[model samples]
Target: MNYQYNNFYEILEKNAKNLKNKPAYFLNNRKISWERVKKKVDTFARALEIIGVKKGDLVPVLVGNSIEFIVAILAIQKLSAVAVPVNTFLKEEEITFILNDTEAEILIASSKFKNNLKNIRNNTNIKKIIWEGEVENIDENNISFSEILSNFESHEVKELPKRNDLAVIIYTSGTTGKPKGAMLTYKNFFSNIYGINELIKLTNKDRFIAYLPMFHSFTLTVNILLPMFYGSPVVIIRSIMPFSKIIKETLLKRVTIFTGVPDVYSALSRAKLPFYFHWFNKIRFFVSGAAPLAGEVLERFSKKFKRAKLLEGYGLSECSPVVAVNRAELQKPSSVGPAIPGVEVKIVNDELIEVPKGVAGEIIVKGDNVMKGYYKREDATQQTIINGWLLTGDIGKIDEDGYIYILDRKKDLIISKGVNIYPREIEEICLKFPGIKECAVIGKKENNDEIPVAFIELEDNAEFNEIEFKKYLKKHLANYKIPKAFYVIDELPKNATGKVLKRKLRENIEEYMK
Candidate 1:
């Protein structure tokens, strides 16, 4: 795909000139225009440069889903510095590991996570902490973000980042070992913007909604960056809880492009709404990412929202996170449509040889959206990206029509009763059960054999009955594929983006089993 701009800063500059006073962002009742956005970003960039930040410097951002998050990141980009966005939900240890691994000198974090920053100064190379929310007083190290926005003057960024320069370092979830930082360049992000826009259609006249965590690649590229690149105003919803707020904002703000995970779609599909919301809401397209869209959820969503299409997409952090999605006009039942324009997808065997279309193998992707490399881990980087194709470590297959079906994670496979069982297949079926809010299946040892066990979270008014659940499972799954046991928990462990963290469940399975 041909990159449109040299970097994000260039795009922001162009939007300032052409879009003028159009809203760049909306938070609650506040509207920030592109003109104001450019000014704030420039001033923040100057503030960053004043505090000893230089080109190629890595600045870790720990802000939440607010306008300040966008401003802080772009401001870092304006000075040609790399912005390392860390998950604010992480504990002190996880956050420290990333800060130390990146060797970032400056840290930008929201004050909501202030308790996590108690000894952050002594733990990492952090020399300054630019706090984004309410702080009683600003110390030498703890600088008030409000002060910068109000006191600093906007200055021209003499050296803007190029397409090849490193733009961000997104850390993997580190399910197995230490999290590896995927280094993404400006061109990588631009390629994703170019590739996705070709499949999913939207324009500057539309408004995009972003409630997912910004640290996730899907939210960063699709929700945050894509709309900005297209010159559309983005509605920044800080949290997804009390989901009614999202629905109200959608109606009030006239949001046309909605992006979320499977849980959000499932809730929206099952949620009974007043006819007025259905008749007047301007939701033209609903995009699902970060996890697979359950078929049952899609079917219910289609029946519920006839005017909009829930285009399910697949992506990972290493590929600038968006590889493919169902087109707005056409969609397959369970497949993540075809690869976006300019991307190549193939099912390959263990040796990286292409397999038959219908055969399940490793899914590898080749495109400009692929990351530059994993930071400071040449061995891991080489293993991930081979011959310009990223080995997704996901077991899936390409259909004859080019639609892709993700069967399961390679490591999450279960061999039960001498047959291979994919947990997602069971989990997807379980999600169809009434009163089941979320379901997660994992392989556990039973005697000498490995069996599939389920951990579920039920709806508020729903109770789990073993006989009823087993009956529900037996209807859709083979005896061997059905979970050997069911455990009802308050909630399923999830990452910031709402993807089920099976590794965590597997690690702590014994505690729940007893």
Candidate 2:
């Protein structure tokens, strides 16, 4: 369990030397070897240096999950620069805010997002715009991906970054306000890589499917960092659309480890597979994170796949994102499992006192994997991390056996007549309905009182009876905890990371009032 590598670069170098001809990345029917990836990283690092990107400089990357995006980030790490990955689904205003807030010297983006960047060029401090694909009307400042690789010569970089040096700045999904960048150092990522490595026990022979958004911490660590650290091959698929393609790739490549959000698993569970769909049998297991995975979804997925085990985990952007996960051997479907190695987690009451076992309280963590602080937001950072513990803002309970059960987000709690109601509890019950595809529970204000409301999306050709649903809920929950009203919707508003934006649902409460 001793990790000999000091930094991410060292991990890559070690993997390249040991697994030279192995396929490091599989994308678009092309296999990129570890040796070639190392060479491309070196060449891109030289190109970045030629363009005046020095150590500690921030380089904001706006790209999808592709080989070029991987190369760009590895190149930035080679030069000890911080890679600020912007969510691809952000509005122009939000993207502009991140670029300005980070003061990024260079913006490396795919050509698909050029329109979003074109409008904000004059407003930010970006000196160079490097496009990963083809583009028209290119100028000196706006350069293409091929041009950089062809123009710059590959050279060895001697200046290595320290473990404490800042590596990347991940912006929170910002369900409430403007997104704040979580500053993660090399040590943070390295510690998490090791911690997760011990849990999953991945090897060079393992193949992973890289379908989640790379900007998010869960995808970055599990799909990218873990595979590279263990010299495993990753199959990169840019789009999750036409999910048949995902199934095809997973089967064809024999993907062993699949990491995804709860929504992805829910969809896969509902997808109708052919009788010959024996491809998933090769998959070792599936990991669910980003949002809470409903027990119903896990049960359905396990029944459908038959051979695949769906494990739930918990994390946030601030903790280099892998706080705890369930192990395959000692699986607990209800718990996200104990804290990973090298990390300490505890449940604290309102006054920050450690709560007794089996009592719900705020979950806080202290470890090397915790982020340094929020970028340029000292007040918010202070509020999030107090007394050297990163306050997770999540409500959960730890059992005497050390299994952690997440109850709900502290902010998502609803108070009705001095009684506390957790929205997750209602949503979990709503999911048990036969026709319910997706659902969200929020508190709506009515005449100075808060009332629980349920918004649901039904499956195709599925029937909905409000009375029957209420009758079903009465058996599982107290009358005060049941939703006062239920509104049928097509879909819930989600952020780039696939988390439901409850704030948006709260804003449109009038639409659901009827």
Instruction: Show the colliding residue pairs in model 1.
Output: none
- Model 2, 514: alpha-carbon shift in Å? 5.3
What TM-score, to 2 decimals, does candidate 2 have?
0.97
Q: Per-residue error at 16 for model 1, in Å?
A: 0.6
Residue-by-residue lDDT tens digits, candidate 2, 47-101: 8898888888999999999988889988998899999988998878889999999
Which has the greatest lDDT?
A: 1
Worst 10 residues of 1 by lDDT: 194-203
Candidate 2 stretches greater than 4 Å from native: 1-3
TM-scores for all candidates: the values are: 0.97, 0.97
lDDT of 2 at 63: 92
Whole-structure CA lDDT of model 2 = 0.87
